[model samples]
Target chain A: MCGIVGLFLKKDDLRPQLGDMLTDMLITMTDRGPDSAGIAIYGPETEGMVKITVQSDSPETAFAHLDAALCAAIDAPVTIKVIDTHAVLTVPEASEAAAIAWLEETGLRIMGSGASMEIYKEVGLPKDVAARFGLREMGGSHGIGHTRMATESAVTTMGAHPFSTADDQCLVHNGSLSNHNQMRRTLARKGVFTRSENDTEVGAAYISSRIAEGATLGEALEGTIKDLDGFFTFVTGTRNGFGVVRDPIACKPAVMAETEDYVAFASEYRAFADLPGIEAARVWEPEPATVYFWER
Target chain B: MTTTLDMTATDLRAVNTTLQAAARAQANEDYEIINPRGAHAMACGLDGPLTVTIKGSTGYYCAGMNKEATVTVEGSAGPGVAENMMSGIVTIEGDASQYAGATGHGGLLNIKGNASSRCGISMKGIDIVVHGNIGHMSAFMAQKGNLVVLGDAGDALGDSLYEARLFVRGSVKSLGADCIEKEMRPEHLEILAKLLEQAGADAKPEEFKRYGSARKLYNFNIDHADEY
Candidate 1:
């Protein structure tokens, strides 16, 4: 079993509390998935700059002098902020591809790259991972967190969820996909590749490929219900939208609550018990094979 | 007197142990649980007469295996609420998650709001009344009892059923294998009326249609062996 929690703030005032709220929500779901935890926060954005989140086993050595070296190599200004094993490198938007290539050549694993999103994940308990990243102090407009129990792959750092395959687009899943191996081959033939052996990463790559082919976020999520087999309750995020969808046979539990201020999704109601104004939110379970999306 | 147990202050095991002891001793007391916060398995395994009112929502398996105890959740419930219940009544003021009242033996499970998939699956002699719609694969392999729905039923309702009576006031998307629409006889109406009254449902019994097993797949004939 896995736990997924997503929060989309409709009001600008709640942006500062997004990380704190999401941290509590993710920790409450510790029992649902204790193998690993991850979070993707869509924080403040800078014009003409892109953020590339990368993780290294030895951040002290790998990150040292990395920004200066990348700046000189790409001939563009690069600033890296290290948080635990992960670092967010902000580079010129025009030089993102070059920066990513150079960073990849350095053997650093790219977690995600986007205009505003920063992804952090590790193999540990949810509370420990949250503490390691100081997740409670961060702020964002929206975010998605995942606690994984590792059904389809090993419990490694790469297996942790909030798998991001495209810029500012990520997905966290609660159920196992039965046809991921077959689907992985189909995507590979289309020039789309996944980094990890995790089934959820394949799901993420599939969504990213669909979006790259000019599908909307809602349409890409709807395609999952038709193409992907087995049970799944997926919560996906983009630059300006958050989407949710469940498979036809929705054995995996999902509960959503929407107030005037925010839209929240979780694998269970317990994850939402402490949200602000939750006592009066319009809470309901998303129907099977239906795509529900909220856009800014 | 109504004893209050605050879950935020006392742990879940201690609270459940207190309620279980009350049931075993037949304390016949009223207990109010506060700050449930969607905790799983709240007030389970009771065997005697008692009254439990959970102030907020609960997690999985709430009021499971109940006997002679009337447990009420003032808010919603998670999965497997009242599962395997033996007797007495369990009520939910709000919606219930998947597999509500699954494999229950006896007593009444009244969900005032919607119930997700697999409601009353493999139920044996239990009576469940859902005021709102139920999801797919409900009452699959149900043995005996009554499932009354005041609203619509999702796809594949009552698949592979066995003797359980299903009454729906609204539309049914589809019926499962070995399940078909059955005539509403006077005896069936009698059962429906009693359950509706006990569940505090306002729907009239005459507005419903009954469904049950066709009994074709029960015996496994050689002609249908390839289909299986």
Candidate 2:
């Protein structure tokens, strides 16, 4: 079991409160799944620049001289911002692939790579995880958070959610996949490698592979109902949009609220009670097997 | 005595504790619960004839296992509202999510708006009345009681039903196995009339068609194997 929370702001004024609102939303679901938690935030982006968020067990050594090493290897200017155990690196857009490759060879794990998105996750109570990363002060256009209770995999940071393998794409899941091992092998054969043994990571890779092959977000999500077998409610975020889908059975609980200012998705209605102007929001459950997406 | 509890500050446990104390003392008190904010398991295990009115929406399993209180939700309800209730009156002013009144043994559950799928599954003597439409598979495997749907009934109504009387004023998409349209005798019409009056519904009893178990597969008969 897990808790998934997502917010896509339609109004720019609410961006400053994105982290604060998301933090409140995630913590409300602490009773749902309290093992581990993670979040992915999509913030402002610069022209022709990409950001790569990475996590290290020992940040003092893993991050030291990392910017200089990457800048020298890729022959491009790279800047890094360290927040606790995670670091966000900004580099020339063209060198993103090369920089990622260079970092991987140096035995560093890349959490996420996108034009504006940065992912931070760890194994702990959601409240502690959020406090460790100072998540309440960060702001973004759209964000997704997950609190996980391990079912198929061991409880570890690598098993936590917001698994992103492609640029500008990440997904958090609330249910288990019945056929993930088969699909994982299928994705691996197509050259999409998921770094963790978590089933949710395989789900994320499947969507990324589909989008990489030029399928629209809706089409890719629809494909999940046919190709993947499981009870799942997936909330995915891209550079410009947020998407939600439930399996045909829709066994997991998911509620969505949309207003003039923003669209929110949560595993339960309590997560939405604290949002600003929520009493007037159009609250309802998304239909089973249907893809609901919103873009800025 | 009548009291008011503000859930936004007092939390759910305090409200429950106060109600439990009132019930233990047999004080037929009236309570006003404000700002429930979609919390689960509110007003559960009520065993006294008290009046508890919730001012806002509630999350899952609200009013579950109620014994004798009269509970009312001023707003919508999440899944399993009034589930496993042995006795009482639970009313919803707005729509209800899935499994409303599920596995109830004895109670009167009334929903002013639509109810989602599995409205009264496995019911055992509860009287459920939905003013609006109900989703698929309602009254599945019900052992006994009455289900009155004033609006339309979705697919597979009363599947595997056993002795439960279902009255639908609107169309039924399909009937479940062992469930079939039955003759609405005067006794059934009288039951429906009483149910409508108890629920404060406006629909006429004559507009509804009664449904129940066919009893064709109630016992093991090789001749009915094909039907099974």
Candidate 3:
């Protein structure tokens, strides 16, 4: 089992509350999946690195190469944080075209990227992970987080989520994707690269490529329902807004509560309990094979 | 001591207050729960000779850490009820949810009605007796336990399993990997009778059948690895 959440903040005034609020939500779901935690945030006007996260078996070896290659790779200095097997770095702001290239070439296989989308992840408890990324006081209008149990792939940072596509769109998942290898083969044919064995990454890239073309988040999500097999509850973070989707069976659990201030979704209700005055917020399961999207 | 809870109140603090008050008012070794709501995680980790008689339905993980305590529910239960019970007795008067006796190390679970999937999954050493129909994967991965299903069973029963004795009286959809049907011996019948008596069951000894592991998964070999 895994816990996933995404938020679309309608009001800019609520941006400052995003990190703390999302952190609280992630903490509540710690029990569902405790292997690792990851987050991706997107803002309308920010120029951010489509960040790529990876965890090499040896952090020391990984860091030496990262530090040496920072100057040759991008135009600006690299901002990086390291702990244990996990690490995150901001690849100084780059254009959509350059960002895409930088993401694919990161020393680690490009499982996903957060650009204009601030991505954060760590290998520990939800709150501990947020603390590792200094998320407690940080603020953003839209973001997503995941706690993974690793039913399909080995529990590693490389396999953890918030997968990206087309260097812009990012996606997180709560259930298994049955048609993973088939989807990967198709994406590979289109020159889209996949880094990890995780099936969610393929789906993320699939959505990212679609949004890059012209389809809206909802259309791309609904389109994948028939193509992507197996049980899946997805939360996508996009430039315009955030959206959620579920597979036909709804075998995985997901509940969403939309308030005047924010739209929050989680695998369970306990995670979103601290959303100011939103006590037990009318939590209801999202319909199977349905997708919901909104932006403000 | 007999105490009942109101169904309207969702807050456990109010209901706990009643249970605590009843425990304080009565000095007897056995206690009774008169009216229970759809409360979850009830009577978790309780000890001593207290007997909790739930009057109505309950939610998830009731009597989770039952020690010397004995809890009897008058109605059905939600998921994970009696999960990880260490030692004691948990009796359900009606149907039980999935993982009815999941990972229970030691205890006696008596289900009078149907039981959902994974009824005795990952049981450590507990004894569970279900009087009616049971769902799929009834003993999926049970490590050590005595499971008695007096009715029909479903597919993958005892799949990828461990040392657990399963007794079913009706049709079994399918047996899991390395699992096979066993004989109902006189000694095993006596053991079943003792378990039934603990569960407050009054069924005849002849009305049961036995099923368990073939022990093929215990040893490792190139040919058998794929079967696992």
* Residue clash pairs of candidate 3: A50-A114, A50-A115, A51-A114, B33-B53
lDDT tens digits by residue: candidate 3, A221-242: 9888988888788998876678
Q: For candidate 1 chain B, which ten residues in a row score worst on lDDT?
A: B219-228
Winner by TM-score between candidate 2 and candidate 1: 1
lDDT of 1 by residue, A1-296 (tens): 99999999999998889989999999999998999999999999999999999999999999999999999999999998999999999999999999999999999999999998999999999999999999999999899999999899999888998999999999999999999999999999999999999889999999999999999888899899889988899999899969999999898999999999999999999999899998888889898899999999
- Report how far off residue B91 is in candidate 1 (Å): 0.2
Once fitted onto the true fold, the runs of candidate 2 whose alpha carbons sit more than 4 angstroms away are: B152-155, B169-175, B183-186, B206-209, B221-228
Worst 10 residues of 3 chain B by lDDT: B19-28
Q: Pick the candidate with the highest DockQ.
A: 1
Predicted complex 2: DockQ: 0.58
Model 2, C-alpha of A40: deviation from truth (Å)? 1.3
Q: State the C-alpha lDDT per candidate.
A: 0.94, 0.91, 0.73
Per-residue C-alpha lDDT of model 2 across residues B13-121, encoded as one tens digit per residue: 8888888777667777899898899999999988888899998888999999988888999887888999999988999988888889999999899999888788899
Per-model RMSD to reference: 0.9, 2.3, 10.6
- List, for all models, the DockQ compared with the true complex: 0.82, 0.58, 0.04
Residue B146 in candidate 3, Cα distance off native in Å: 33
